[model samples]
Target chain A: MDPSQVDVPPLKDLTIDNITDNVKLINSGCPDPRLKYLLERLVQHMHDFARETRLSHNEWMTAIQFLTSVGQICTDVRQEFILLSDILGLSLLVDSIDHPKPASSTEGTVLGPFHTHDAPPEPNGTQIAHDPAGEPCLVLCTVKDTEGKPIEGVKIDIWETDSSGKYDVQYEGREAPDQRAVMTSDAEGIFWFKAIVPVPYPIPNDGPVGKLLTLLKRHCYRPSHMHFMMEKEGFDHLITALYLRGDPYETSDAVFGVKESLLIDLGKVSAGQAKTYGVKEGGKLMSYDFVLVSEKESRELREKNAMYAMKDLGLRMKLYNGLPIPEVD
Target chain B: MDPSQVDVPPLKDLTIDNITDNVKLINSGCPDPRLKYLLERLVQHMHDFARETRLSHNEWMTAIQFLTSVGQICTDVRQEFILLSDILGLSLLVDSIDHPKPASSTEGTVLGPFHTHDAPPEPNGTQIAHDPAGEPCLVLCTVKDTEGKPIEGVKIDIWETDSSGKYDVQYEGREAPDQRAVMTSDAEGIFWFKAIVPVPYPIPNDGPVGKLLTLLKRHCYRPSHMHFMMEKEGFDHLITALYLRGDPYETSDAVFGVKESLLIDLGKVSAGQAKTYGVKEGGKLMSYDFVLVSEKESRELREKNAMYAMKDLGLRMKLYNGLPIPEVD
Candidate 1:
């Protein structure tokens, strides 16, 4: 063995090249061809971007901390990160890319922060509101086919906030789901739920996401509205929500989930129409209908079960062994 | 407020498209465009990578932990992460892209981990070995123009290990810069350092880098070689090391810092050449002459400092909110 080769010093680490390497590892092997390409290109671009911005470890850790807080704030009723996604226009961008509308049917908007499948179905024109003090209202919805023909017997699942701006899931269980009800349309593809108009309110922020907003100089509130889950034969399942006529976050919902057609006006009805719905004289009420296109699924359909926390645990174990998983549970 | 316009959640503070908006409070800008681009890209990719990989909170924290350990392992004498860079071939890629050499000049290898810029200069044909146990050798060199014509007054700053396989910096200040020395040549650009043949040795592996290597299933040793810094007016500054032929790491040096021209063979020398260098009749040494071309200033010179660490500190601070710093100083 020639003795002269041993004593030289090693070079410096943390060069731009190595940083790029670690990022590539994150893109190891995604199943989705398009997602894989997007992620690979994104990883390359991000590494180049980080190197270009000269982002420091100190700053990166803060971002991690903020994301953690965003996760922490999420619960059965709230998803602040989704709100963040909407406002950033990422969700809208993805949604539009995945589901481009032709502008004829009811515009699809974000499925606002609260939605649950299989809500208890109520009879047509029945009051879904548990709060007697909420503004007396009606939600008349028409489930239409592509040709604008009303599709009778279509199931339109509905959930929303009460007059106090709180969801039923937020309260105790065993009573029926408050502000949450399901309705099936009649022969005209028209379905109406007797209820109260939702109140506008801000999303809960008392976490790192809030801290992030302070750093970015922005606000955190979502306009109030009812959510809709509808399914029809030969059409994709629609998970969407409609917005009220007037609220502050109309243009800048934190989740950027709004679409132009989803906005609807609840016009005042004549006393003659109100009497048919058992409304007292001078009682305030509203009605509107929604149109849903087939909702295409983007990601591989992972079995979504009630044991979400367990699924999250399982996913973590998988990745610890260097396996990859989607961020959702 | 038009309630119809209000279905979206309010925009929040978690995202920003520009780095300057956050860094502006500090009044500093990144100098290198590529570095800037890299840092920005890194941040974007890492976040997306984390999101895509569903990099969990604990996992993200674990990464931060791993990085800190990597940092803690770095010292004045050893840099395992840098060694990692070398082994991964990142350093070579950088060196190759930045320093393209012509076919005529001595090729550049890694500036191994133990370089101290100021070596004492020696006269032409001077003996550089402090121990007589080294191989008795002669390095006859001829410096010339790119066309092979000789040039004068060339200086060759050289340093290398001794027969014991240790560097001056490897051990404490007990030995006076063992087998390494600086030397200048005649008007022709030819000079050599006479040192005992050094043995190959393993780099420091008792730290974080060592731990990482253990995890990565990699070795921590490098081949033996002498460090060389060839600088002249009009020639590109070549900071490189020469690898002795036949060392084990000559093929798999933990740093992968080897080049073809860097490989040199040591043979027995004549009594007449030994007498000229003041070596005894049968001393141990070898001979090597470096041929260099007119060094071109690196093209990156037109660019600013492109290192990501400097470019990204603010982002680090912003993300981590004051990450713990290593007590290296």
Candidate 2:
């Protein structure tokens, strides 16, 4: 008989809470220690959810669509799926659990949603932004080892949005890349940049990831922050982001990028003296030293730039299928 | 900034085998039990696979596409997706893991990729197919209770392919539903039918499922067999396929549906005796009976069917969005 032509059966009443035996069996078959443990745990939680909400097929399909969109919207520049991970708190948990940096070392936070590989190379203390589009501020920083001894001649790359919370490359209207620059730490492990105070801004949510947040009743704004990646001969290339302290949205940073140490106070300074530091007095200026643990090992120095990206296929039909599965970088 | 316009950073090296810790950490904050464990296991397997084969991103994408196709091609009638599950041994493993039938009782097998609900009612001893198609044989079957008592007046639905191992419905030029029929068990729990000895046949390999089998270098054929479903008031309904002993493809059953008890011997019989049994009785005939267990009090029985069905969206999506989650049957 044509199985396909048969009438559909009535729906069943399945849920997670009642499947302990089944879960046990599945676990028994999982030979991989990690996978076996995970399956056991995953199935347990799944069953618990089914039991808890009594979820329906329509709900399940809706989630499928949500995930599909997350994948579909992924591109080399953006990762909605990773954003989803961030919003769900999975990314934070992962970062925290994997990193056990000793005290005094710069704490690690999320790599935010955007991180460009290169910044225009600048010498020590060179200003990054070509123009001020936000509150003008002067930033100073120093690098040191865990022992608090200064480490000199280190490369530091810094990038951030203007007072408008916009990156230089973000503005197509910009005649040139405005706010990103590179610098080197001086003999005392000190370097400074002149730029506008960054402001809290909304993340790009016009796509499916935003739609999902709307559905989940979550906000799509990230706290204002600056990105930094420092590298010295034998030290772990530090990748981290610092958030503006007291930013109203800091508590609910969309990417959950804020950390206790990364949040810095942007104290106000007198206008004339601020001018000496390259900013209008009475505007916010901040100063802090980045104490990086010396490249402790070669492993950290060889770190891969942890950025999330997916392919886009809207090119011509000839390129639609993609480069015959091009080699993954 | 146009996120895509930034010079893309290199991706971190990740493998399926070494992802155990990654899964654990990523899901460390997941309050839901299943999602945490599932992600942990999935990551582990993914990393393990990567470590073992050094799989590239393109290959990973290929896997993602293959999984997507499995979901896309699935429908109520043609569950190629489920077949994919069976081929991967996931279905059987899941079924067995989730539903551990007593070793002494019928070992629940993969509910092959096809199953329909509405079957036209038929009476005891009524032949579903008139002409014998494959090997000529008489099917003898009786339903019994856990105590070995007879289950009289049970409804036994029957269907099988022809001597050439061709299912009537599988043929394009067919005018009728061949090699199929339904009959009820008599008061003595006995039922018999005459049909041609069936031949082994290959499963449909035109779809992505076939492509996977080819990629995995597996044979895609199954030994000829009869399908049956028996139900009565006192015991749980049994839905199972019975394989013909000595069928050429028995060892290589495509979906691995073979069971020791389900195999029926195909033996020669005298012509007059065949006439007595209402069969032509010259050639080989495959025959077998079915056994079913009684329904027990549990939450899983009510929802087992739904849980297995909802897994088409991948384990993660199923946990998040798919609902009406079935209990382990």
Pairing residues by index, what is the TM-score of model 1?
Answer: 0.47
Tell me chain A's TM-score in each of the predictions: 0.74, 0.69
Query: How large an RMSD does model 1 have?
Result: 15.7
DockQ of each: 0.05, 0.04
Model 1: residues with Cα > 4 Å off, grouped in runs: A1-14, A18-35, A171-176, A257-260, A294-329, B1-329
Every model's Cα RMSD, please? 15.7, 14.0
lDDT of 2 by residue, B137-189 (tens): 66656766656666777777666666565555555665555556667777766
Per-residue lDDT over A1-329 for candidate 2, one digit per residue giving the tens place of the 0 to 100 score: 12223221221111132234433342343334333333444444444444333433334335545545555555545556556655554454444433335566887666555666556778755667655446666777889887788888888878777766666545545455557777888888888877777777877677776764454345666777888888788775676777787776666565556677888888776766566666566766677778776544322321211111112322111111221111320
Reproduced native contacts, each prediction: 0.07, 0.01
Question: Which candidate comes out best when scored by TM-score?
Answer: 2
DockQ of structure 1: 0.05
Model 1, B212-261: lDDT tens digits are 44444455667777767766687666667767777766655666566667
Error of 2 at B26 (Å): 16
lDDT of each: 0.54, 0.55
